[model samples]
Target: MGTSVGPSAGLSPKYQRLIQRTLRIERQPKLELQNERQQKKNTKSLVSDLDGKLSSLQSQLSTLTDTTSSPFDGRNASAAEGTEGFSVSADETASTGSYSLAVNRLASEDGRVSQTFDADKSNLSDFFTNNGAQTFSVDVSTPTDSNPDARTSIDVTVDSDGTNNKEVLSDIQSAIDSAFQSAVDDGTLSADQRPSASVINPTSGTARLSLRSQQTGYQGRLSFSDSSNNLLSELQVNADQIADDTQGGEITEVGTDEASSKLTSEFELNGLTFTRNSNEVTDAVDGVTMNLEEANGTASSFEVTADEEGAQSVVKNFVDRVNEVITFLNEKTNVNPENGERGELADDSTFRRLSRQLRTDATRPVEGQPEGLNTLADIGIEANRDGTLKLTDEDALRTAVRENQGALKDLFAGPDGVATRMKERVDQYADTGGLLDSRQDSIDSSIDRIDDRINGLDERLQRREQQLREQYAEVESTIRSLASQQQSISQRLF
Candidate 1:
């Protein structure tokens, strides 16, 4: 039992040629394994690409299916001409009606400015003789309650670090913000109750401390008071000019606050009166927020209507994603132009089914919608000859949405809608542990097996090569000894 092949009885055996032939035969399996590995890699990549496109299509479909979001219930609003002081947002709850808005006085924040000083040169030592806790309080009066009576007044104390004027002002601002935030945290004051503080250096080359009510309108009127007169006076803020809620006044300009007493914003809508401390009123209308931009006593008309931009965007995205998936399927399944090589999943049946399913879902008519609104075609979306979805007429779609939004909504995202069905179908191919996942796992496993066989073959080939070399070396030595013996015997005979 010889372990190796025939060794030449001549000068030496042709071991190189034998090893080459044997190795060539043995490496066939390894070569095949490598090719299979590459094919599997390409297949996995194809599946992965399909998965991403399908997932995106599903997400877009989800947006259309979630009817509770009122995806089609968009709102648009506009103020009457010559109106500069207000804006509005109309939602699902807003009616298709116009309102005559008369702003008796636009709500303004209780605001005040500091007397001026030189920012670079001034220090806290000039104002406060002692670097201790100095207290400042904010008083707010609403229709229900007035502050400075403890509950409505937010008191904050600033601890002077005995630093420069800039640091002093900054510390004061920080302390005020912290106090309000603490109140909000403790449920003492609402988040909106916070006051704002800033250091203003006007052209006077002097720095002044500016303080204002964080809130707007009459209730947000600010009144500044210091238990220590030195605090307000040194800061150069006028404590005497507090705004009184009883006197309603309008500012001719934006920044000029004549008094410390801030005026509450007063406005009338549809002959109904409304009063708020701030110009920005959230509760004025149901599902509608009112921002009193200006107080024009004259009637300013605003109309609330549906905003179609959001719904239109969602619709556009759905079409684009459908086309993307179609393009991917077309390219992957077709042969490459440059090399004439087919794609990894060119004959993939599962991918073919997935592509056909998506197109069918998009073209299918939604159940329960009107005959004119049930299908994607009815909503101005049509399939082209190339099997791609196209919004054929944007104006028609927009008109459809504007006129019968409910019908369009039902067709796209209703219980038996096109988007919903498409999403569900996509899930079969792209979801976790779904068809694509199974396919990818199978590919990865094949690659793993090929790698194992290739490694084993590598070890076997190395051993076989060494054995051939050793056997041929021994054959060469034997031939050398035989030739020497024959030559010596012939010489003696002669």
Candidate 2:
């Protein structure tokens, strides 16, 4: 047998694989395209990070710029140690002052209990539904007599099918609650003036109806009258159980005489006494709300001061956010001097420009600020050598917040101020359709283009590979035929 020179003559599986491998070498070089894509992905990631930092910095600045809610305008109220009977708080409008406070009484809600009835045996529905009368009305009057006619009335309808005392009492309670809630929803009754009814059923004993006013103190006194039925009379809760419903159909008293003291809050501020119908008193002092928890005869000192710590915290947070943006830009835009290694964004001029703008705005003096309160440096927020902020002198910041808060706020949050300008600049990059978005879109488009080019190159390479396979097959067949003719001639000559 003679050796054949066809493509399959020595083309074992291993040899065929080698040929295929060699053909793959002729395919397009995608290393550069792949590297470019990776670089673009990295840039996009960095840009996203930059966008996030800028957005955070802008949000921190917004808080400072809002005059109505500026942290610098905040106030704090502090009561002297060992002070009794009260807790107090102050808002931005509170005056910074010291005053003596004394609480004589804490206001309470008005409540009344009906006569007891058998829990399971007594049937209240029969009494209430007499003469087909199944409806009742309740009135809640104002604490002051200035407007005697100023009262709210709610009508309750009883459920007729209730069988026992407890069931009937529960139905009446539900009806009353529904009526009052409906009045509130319909704007006929104020929520504070709405009364409540409950069926008080004790275990192994009798049941009773409990009527209470939601409003604290005298304002919460309740009165009952027959509308379509004598529901209150049936329960024995009317006619001076607490007090007779008089004074033009409004009950002036609903609780026992001893409980009357709890109907109004009494306190003294700066030796001047005051009384109110609520334990939480907001009108005694401007911008100050005091909660009288209990009554103590002794007076105690309370101080209202500027919330320097709160303002400091806001300032510190702003500074920290600013530093984060600055630091991120610095690191990404930095180039190592020793190794000449470039950062992710070192070649981008936009980030470098933003970094400079942020640093300049943070450190620059304001246009209209007074000399003593001109710059952040004056308030102890100073720039480090690397353009980051540091709270160098916390005491200085506190003093500024304590004494010159308005000017300090103006320095950072005022119109054309540091935070205002920085925020405006950041918005150009961080907002939708802004610089970062545009840059991201451009990078994505470039990546798409590269992918398209790679795909085209691959298609061309696949076609070329197929052509080479056909050409190699033809060459192998010619070689095998020539070798066969040479073998026949050699054998005939032998």
Candidate 3:
């Protein structure tokens, strides 16, 4: 057979080379698989860290939402029971009894009564007797013609040469204008306070400056004086002259004895006032006391006891809290700070379901009320399309709070009230073994097991790689020894 030196003889070398190359490639894939497994482990750890932070934030948000949205605040029925459907009587008053009755009235300033009728003999006599020797200074100058057709007029100037006399007319006008502006700004000025100022220059060349005080029964006239207290102007009159002037004059009624009362029950504890036959109460005068009478001819002895303000405040605070919760949830669940992306919580099935449940709870009807009392709509609270609460009608809310406070209380304080229900639900989900806790625990356990498995795999892979390296080294040594023998033989043969 001549030692069969065919292709089979060379195939051994090629087959060994192929096996070595295949081993190298297979080792590379094992290393790559190890890297991929490690990368997966790192990703899982990152997800766990993020989930922990998110769970913590959600817990905090849940606490805040519960605190701010508590429907139990101001739900106490004590104040309502004491205030509603109650009538008070002034006859129940004792001289020193510590009795308090809330009366509704208009708020006004305090001041002297408005003056009227300056021509009465007794009034004029009293005015001049007490106001004699009061002086005023008058300086009249010829008016420069602004219009040619207009009659020649006289102008009055005060201390024209003195340093303090600069723009005296302008200063006076400014003062008057400022006073009017102030009255307008205060929102309390009445018609009686709208007084006008005028400067008169009689043909006698005497310039008279007068301030007609907006008051009734003026017992004295005004006196004008110089800076040095010297009398500048005064009206001289005897008792006989005053009496004759009073007798000759027409009886003019300048002011009336109208009673002014305002009703302030809506806004404040202050009672309303009734002004008899006159609108003087609307004047800008401060602290003018008219009779404080009720519209029904009764004394100010009405008692309106209700928790209206407190209830409304509670509802408002609750609505505000709920909105805050919504905002917080939206931020936490949907928004990603890095990429500006929405978070898992933003449209989370659990969160949306809970929000809808809360809304239904809030708007649920009161028990024993056939017409379905105590809805959010009744108190002017409306829900937006985004599942948030809004206050739309403040007046209507106030009225509902005032009138149906009991129903309002029951709506939130009843067995199925929003507060109670929310507390139960939140507590259930937030408990140690609750939904969030269970999920987190499960994830933690999974991570722990995965870490254990990865650690075991790492140990096994290290041992396997060491053993494979030793085996390859032994194989290379044997192969190299055999090749050396073959080379030596060939060299000897050559």
Candidate 4:
């Protein structure tokens, strides 16, 4: 049979598919490079996590080594029955012992108030001293302290129509409060030591003004006077009314006056007499700051003891941090058997060495412990099958700390200790110019090269496509020409 060819017949489909398949094959290396870059990124992130754990452990270890924060040197104070008002805090230098404490009295400040007046009716302006003087002064007695000036006298000037308006009782109170408030804002007077004023029985014509001490002790008593005015007399403030009040006296014409008198605080500590300007006693006992609340007929006492719970908490934290890093490393360096999925760092020899070193350091004995308890297991921390650690017995750990405090501090903070070695190990991978950084850089470079090669392949494929299209068109033209010639010959023969 004679064969007839269709005009629509074109280049073979397999030929077109051949180059596309080659392009896919060419892209395989780039895809691999992208995946490797991702893996390196994951490894770097895990390294940072491990570094943080190491840093935390180091910080915790510092608490045990520092002379100011050592748990072995820590002490806690407890108030006995009826002694709850006073609380205490101690540092590492605090000596451990029990002492009987008594709150004989708390410190206090001086307070004073002016005599009442009928603002609308009484002629209160006539109370001023002889020479139209409207100023007054207060004498304060706090045990003279070197710093803070403990200003002995405060000057209060009346705010009025400048000697024209008739001043009332409330006007004087406002002026006094204004002066004290200014002192407080200037930092000269402490908030607790600042004076306050209030109007008692306000509506009554016989309303009285009262003042009390801000500091709770006797040294805080206050007395009032005016160099040439009757300000103190009008306010009914006298030395006897304030319990321990004293004021300047013998004011000469435009000259100075006598010095003010002050008082002190008295109390008993453990039947030993102690005196202080203020009721808060700090130096009486080492590392103990006692704030006396009140005097009681029955004596109150408290005790100081070693803090075992604090020490145990520190050790437990150490164990958990160790387990966290170890477990993370193990997970990152291992392949899941069920899924057969390899981890990012599964075949990395450097990470493998690090993982193995981590295991050894955690379980191995440290070189510097004097009691031969060099390993974490000696302090009740032990590793499990899955590379995690647990506190096997908490009591045993506490006993180790209390019995061997010096040894524990040396064991963790010493030259060849677990924390020191682990810190160095983390630095190898996580620090700048470390292995992890270099590995990331290498992967990044490979990915960049893969991208460049991909672009090059695209350009090459475009050129090949252009050449193939031209050759196909030529072949088609020849086939069409041969068919036309055949058709002409057949028609003539017929």
Top lDDT: which candidate number?
2
* Candidate 3 lDDT over residue span 129-210, tens digit each: 4444222322111112583122111121222211221122223334444554455466434445433444333323222222
Off by over 4 Å in 1: 1-14, 80-83, 111-212, 221-262, 271-273, 334-343
Q: TM-score for candidate 1, please give it.
A: 0.72
Q: Judged by lDDT against the true structure, how good is candidate 2?
A: 0.78
What lDDT would candidate 4 get against the real structure? 0.62
lDDT tens string, model 4, 60-140?
A: 655544545566556677777656546566555567666766555444455454444554444455544334547887655
Q: Please provide TM-scores, in order, for all candidate models, with all chains considered together.
A: 0.72, 0.81, 0.38, 0.77
The per-model lDDT (C-alpha) reads: 0.72, 0.78, 0.41, 0.62
Number of colliding residue pairs in each model: 25, 0, 42, 16
- 85: Cα error in model 3, Å: 32
Superposition-based RMSD of candidate 3 using all C-alpha atoms, in angstroms = 18.4
Compute the lDDT of residue 343 as modeled in candidate 3. 55
In candidate 1 the C-alpha lDDT for residue 132 amounts to 60
lDDT tens readout by residue for model 1, 1-494: 12444442332336667767887997898899898889889888878888898899888888888756767777777788778767877667766668888877866565666554455564665555554678877665433335322337778887766456666777777887787778779977766666677766655455556666666654455555674645765554544443232221122122333232236677888998777656777777766777887777777788876666777788899999999998798777766779989755678877766667777888987878887888988878999765689988787778876889888888877777888788788888778998889999998999899899889988888887767666776877777799999999999999
